[model samples]
Target: MITRHLTDISSKGFKVHEISGAVDTLHNHNRRDYYKIVLVTGDMILTYGDQTIEINGTILFFANPRVPHTVVHRSKEKKGYACLFTEAFIAGRERAEILQSSPLFRTDANPVIPVNSEQAAFLGSLYREMLSVHRSDYDYRNQLLRSCVELIIHEALKIQPSPNGLQQKNAATRITHLFMELLERQFPVESTGDPLRLRTAQDFAGALSVHVNYLNRAVKGFTGKPTSVHIAERIAAEAKALLQHSNWSIADIAYGLGFEYPTYFNNYFKRVTGATPKSFRKRKV
Candidate 1:
């Protein structure tokens, strides 16, 4: 099964489907490169990260692109709705930050949240409204849909507490967490033209408003790797994904990954993976 990217959806950048309608096509175990929200009314099991969550009755779940998860439909008659959208679709919207900061989207946070029947009905209706707008040709449908998405996020926030609300004992751990979140927010590479903006440890440190040396120490102390190493590894991972999934040429891929020239990217890829991008793609094929 392939990871679903934002471009896989409609040109409008959003789509909603009944869970039962899409279950057969959904991957058994896979990751997605867009945000997802599912409102369900039946029993099922979800393998999210390292934990297995069993849901009975109504539940609302939010998924971030960085987390890999799988859904196991236990009941023959499951009823729910799921919607997917790219970050760009909700960019500049007020609730965008909620998606990033909320417990529902945190990697370590428990994303599966149980809800009462009344709450479930409210959320299910929101999804139904989104589906309706998705099918219409209204000129302002996208704006309305964005509002719907914001409403869903706000509703979920009211139910689930923010995981970050707890105080961390160590400053290094908190800094590392913030750094990782910033790094992940830039990912999935929506377009070959949208090259990665932050490619260095200094770039991240500056964005985080911390000294470069301090950033290095914090990341290294927490993750046992230098900050630059983490940046390079993430970039390399994205490079491999593009090489395997997209039709972009090596030169284009190089530029899209923030390399000054194709040669630099080739050397970096070889250093990290022991295979040039071209060879890697060929082997995958």
Candidate 2:
């Protein structure tokens, strides 16, 4: 299997690379154990979760471990810098990795930010400086790198679109948010040997310590969709991504997606998308 697990790449806690010609070799980016930030200028399409984002100019892109993303590079001129860091690399003196709550990396927030020439120049300069400082013999290089990461976040915030006025969330809304988080945490199906653990609304309710009925009501009330629909939709999305991007066989993909049999998986796929796995993969190819 082609997987980019954090254990294999977190030896130094972080790495910075100059991106050019094409994107990273790996397409399964849901490493769920580290974070990624990239700044690039290009014309391409970014498949982020169930949404597709178009890229034309310089943009600062923030990617978390929670979601799976694929980039279809369309411009050979695309060149910039990418920084990959483990939580241990950025852990604060007194706090854990608080990026889990950062608006820039949130799953629902915009991960792509278009930058003007001036902003891109400054961010690109930081990446270059980080490259130099990271490979130097300076004793405090790590500290400097962490500070640069912070500066990038602060800079992105300056251009981040302001959210609506804050209002206190009701209990239902809070519960619904928790459900969504829990749901998203078990995604990207990295391994065919490891199937999904939570596949039903009842399972989610058990994990949340709430009655299944209550969970269903809260989710439907907040999102106007049933809990089961959300779970299936996410699963179907991952299935499509795996079929399109991985070389795994259909049976392995079915097993990875928690199907008891290939027939079951085919039926589910057809029901959700009106296409069999074979046809879907063929079309994607």
Output the worst ten-in-a-row residue range by lDDT, candidate 2. 1-10
Against the unseen true structure, what C-alpha lDDT does each candidate score? 0.75, 0.78
Model 1 weakest 10-residue run by lDDT: 1-10
Question: Per-candidate TM vs. native?
Answer: 0.60, 0.59
User: lDDT per residue, candidate 2, 179-216, as tens digits?
Assistant: 79878887878997899888899988765546689789
Q: lDDT for model 1, on a 0 to 1 scale?
A: 0.75
Candidate 1 lDDT, tens digit per residue, 1-285?
A: 223434446465777777653344233544454678888776678876545778778888877665567877776666788888776777674664666555444444557778887888898889889889878899999899888887887788788754453432244565687688779878888776788889999998755546688789978988899998899899999999989998889998899888989999999999988999989999776
**How displaced is residue 98 in candidate 2, in Å?**
7.2
Q: Which candidate is the best by lDDT?
A: 2
Q: Considering every candidate listed, which one attains the maximal TM-score?
A: 1
User: Where in model 1 is the C-alpha error above 4 Å?
Assistant: 1-8, 20-26, 29-31, 103-108, 162-226, 229-285
Off by over 4 Å in 2: 1-8, 22-28, 93-101, 164-220, 223-285
